[model samples]
Structure formats: structure tokens, C-alpha cells
Target: MEAHRIFFERPFDYKYAREYSGTLMTPTLWITAAYVILVFGTKAYMKDRKPFDLRRPLQLWNLGLALYSGAAFLIATKEILSTWFNKGLTATYTDINSFYEGTCGAWAYLFMISKYYELGDTAFLVLRKRPLLLMHWLHHLTTLNLVLAGYHYDTHLYSWLLWMNTFIHTLMYSYYLLASCGYRLPAGFAKKITTMQIIQFCIGLSILAHIGVLKLFTDREVHCNWRMWWGTVFMEILYLTLFSHFYYVSYIKDGGKKFVRDQNEKKQVKAQ
Candidate 1:
């Protein structure tokens, strides 16, 4: 096997990462429960109150998250590609050491911790009286627990999820940041972001299916745990369904006439 330069210079202690994440499992659930309660409570509290103009805070929050996701995406991509170049694609999957013992492991641990920070996104939405959808809050709550569980299980499959998620979030948060600064992309751009999300879910499902086939039909040794694999599949499938419905409702069903009209209005206001 050829050696590749490791981007994560610090020694990765997979054992400690896994054990620490495992310890957080119980606490994370408790926190998520409280988060759900708080989200709804705040939403109700703000129902009659005038929406606060939180433009500056929202911009700063989005800017911070966008930068964080962008940096994480680049590091993860570099780490994974280095392994793929040196060891071949299969090594990244079957070789536990590649994911858990390398620099990516360190980042993966940090990625898991970052989910907690991400919950603040909902805080901004609620405070601003933005129309909070079920998908928005549910996603935040579920992802926090899912990442915690994924790390605790030490599933090699997390490489795919973490890489794709950070990439999506980089784009997603960057878009939000720009919008917060009073810059709106041309019409249909928002839909494109959702489209990318749908594609991501589809690709994730395909990868899981491919791995399942390899594990079941072939003699290849795969390291994915059944619970993690099934859990991911279920979650991705649910997200696909929800997001597809969202696309249909927001764009397709009504021909996106209202959506486009709203965008044009915003643009016109900016023009004036």
C-alpha cells in the first residue's frame, strides 16, 4: 500500500472518540427533547409578538456556520480523496483504519460535536418569526441524535454522510448568509438548493444499497453495522419523501407562480 500525506496531523484516538460519543448518547437525547419543547414554546410565545428585526445577528450566525461548513468540507474531502488516491475506493470502506485511525477520525469527532452548535439555527428562525416548518425543526433534532449515534457506533458509513452533509451545509448556509445580507439570487435558485438536497438523499440511498449488496451477495468484508445502516436508510428515505413533497408543494404543484411572484417582488423592492 502506498502512503499518503495525512492532512490531519494530530494523532487520532478512535477509541476515545467512540467512547466519548457513546457517553453523550443519553445526554443528547435529553437535550434534543428539551430543544423540541423549547422550539415549540418559543414559536407559541412569538405568535402574537411583533417579529424582532434580527438582521445583523442572523447574518453573523449564517456567516459563521457557512465558514465552518466550508472549512470542514474541504478538510474532509482532502482526507477522503487522499485515501482514495493512495488506497483505492474500497479501502476507504472496508479498511476500518482508514476512517477511524486517520486524520478524518479527528474531524469526524468534531463534526459530531458541531451538531450541537447547529441547533442555534432554529433559534434564529424562531426569533425572527420565520415560518418554521416541521421538517426544519425535526431535521435539527434528528441530526443531533443521529450524529451522536453514528459516532458511538463507529460506523465507517459516516464518512459518506459527514462528507455529503458538510458539503450541502456549506452551500446551504452560504445561501442563507447571502440572503441575510439583503442579496437574493435569481429566481429558482432556492429550488435548486432543495433539488441538490434531494439528489444527495438519493445518492446516499444508492450507496447504502450498493453496500448492502456487497455485504450480502459477495464475499467482501464490509464493516457497517446493521442498526446504523438501517437507521440511515430509514432517515434518508424519510428525508427524500419529505423534501420531494416540499418541492412539489413549493414549486411544481402550483407551477411556482406564487414563489416566482414573491421573488420578483423582492427584486423589484431592491431595485427601487
Candidate 2:
């Protein structure tokens, strides 16, 4: 199949200057550098300043996340629609790759840069004197790195993962935004969002597993870069572990009753 042939043939243009040019490496380097400088600088400045005002920055962050989620939804919907109508995964992959090669590629790069923007979420926590959770920082840093690596390797599964995450982040960030605005959604709904993230990771793992199976079992010409495959697998495993831990800490541990009681008490204090 032509689709299988394209998959087997390395998608990268081998000309070093050409392929690596317009890739994520240069921009990611610059963004990561800027983020480090900005975050540390802001942290230092906040040491002598009044408590960080959560209202303004949180509003801005919410808006940014909403826009990003919207974009992801569009991309994912397009891919799913194409796949449904075309009657096969191969065609869907090819069409999506073409989109990536053209416009989606640039958008992905922009999203990679946005990871640096997201570091401000932590800066906000620091300024507000909120305790920084290890999972939060790990997610931010590793997610940025994953985006960089995904682009560098041009992993075929990346498009699918991106599509799913965009959908998930749309919900997750929207919730954060709303909660920051002092709107209390149902606790169960919030928990479900985290659950959805865990599921997303699971789905991503499945895609990687499917690709591995294809390579192992069949004479199919499907080819995947080993680095990309393992990078994705490792990252997904890390995410699963972290998110699962978060779920346990937030909901399941201590019978979850204590957790809810504490949350309600906090809410009452906030209201008072």
C-alpha cells in the first residue's frame, strides 16, 4: 500500500540543513532559555513585592489556554472526520501528516513555544505563596521537552497524541480558568477531568503499542524511529504515574471523605 510505503520510508528529508531547519530545536532552545530567565527573575522580584494578584494573570492564562484548546479541537476533529469518511487509519494518517507538513507543523511549533508561556502558572503559584507541587513542575518541563523531541523525531503517533491532548487541555484549562474566576464547578467534574487526562495517556500508549505490534508481527513496511517510540513510551509512563498519584492524593486516599471535608472547609473560609 502507498500509505504503508510512506510509513516505511523515513519521512525526514535527509538534507541536514533543510530538514533540521524550520524544526523545533532552535525555537525551543530560545524559548526555554527565555523561560528560565523570566521565571527566576520574576521569582526574585516577587520576593520583595506584595503578594501576587491572582485575578489578572489568571484571567490572561485562562484566555490563552482557551484559545489553545480551541485549536486542538479543530485539528482533532478534522483528523477524525477524515478517518471516518475515508474508511482507514492509513489514509487518515497520511492526510494528517500532510496537514502537519504544511500548516499543522507550524502550529505544533507554536504550541511548543507556548510551553514556556505555561511556566507562568508556576510563577503565579510562587507569587501567591502557594506550595508548588512536584507534579506541576514536572508536567510543565517534561511536556515542553516532549514537544521538542516529538518534532525533532517527527513521530507519526505525535499527531494523534497532540489531537487528543488538545481536547483534554481544552477541558482541563477551561476548568482551571473557571475555578480561578471563583466559579465552583462540581468536584466530581474536576476529578473526571484528571481521569480524562489519565485516559489520554492510556490511549497514547495504545497507539504506540499498536505501532510496535505492526512492526513486530507483520511484514508491513511500517517504520518508526526507535528514539521517538521510546521517548513517547517513557513520557507516557511518567505521566500515567504522576497523574495516577495526583488522583489518589486528591480523591482516593483517606477515604476521599476527609479530602472533601477539607475542601469544603477551605471553601467556607474563602467565602467568609
* Cα RMSD for candidates in order: 4.9, 6.7
How accurate locally is residue 2 in candidate 1, as Cα lDDT from 0 to 100?
12
Candidate 2 residue-wise lDDT, 1-272, digit = tens: 13232123344222231244335566666766776676567667777777756777787788788788778678657755766576567434323455354345555545555676777788777777555667887788778877767655555566676777778778888887887788878878878988999999998888788777776776655435777778879989999999999899888998887569757875974685
Error of 2 at 165 (Å): 0.8
Q: Which ten residues in a row have the lowest lDDT in candidate 2?
A: 1-10
lDDT of 1: 0.79
Misplaced by over 4 Å in model 2 are: 1-50, 90-95, 219-223, 265-269
TM-score of each: 0.89, 0.79
How many clashes in each candidate? 0, 0
lDDT of 1 by residue, 1-272 (tens): 11122223357667766766777788888999999999999999999998777889988988888887888788778877877889878656554465666656677777888899999989988987767888888888888888788778766767877888888889888888898788756666788889989998998898888888888888877777788889989989988988998888778876877677767766765575
Model 2: per-residue Cα lDDT at residue 213: 78
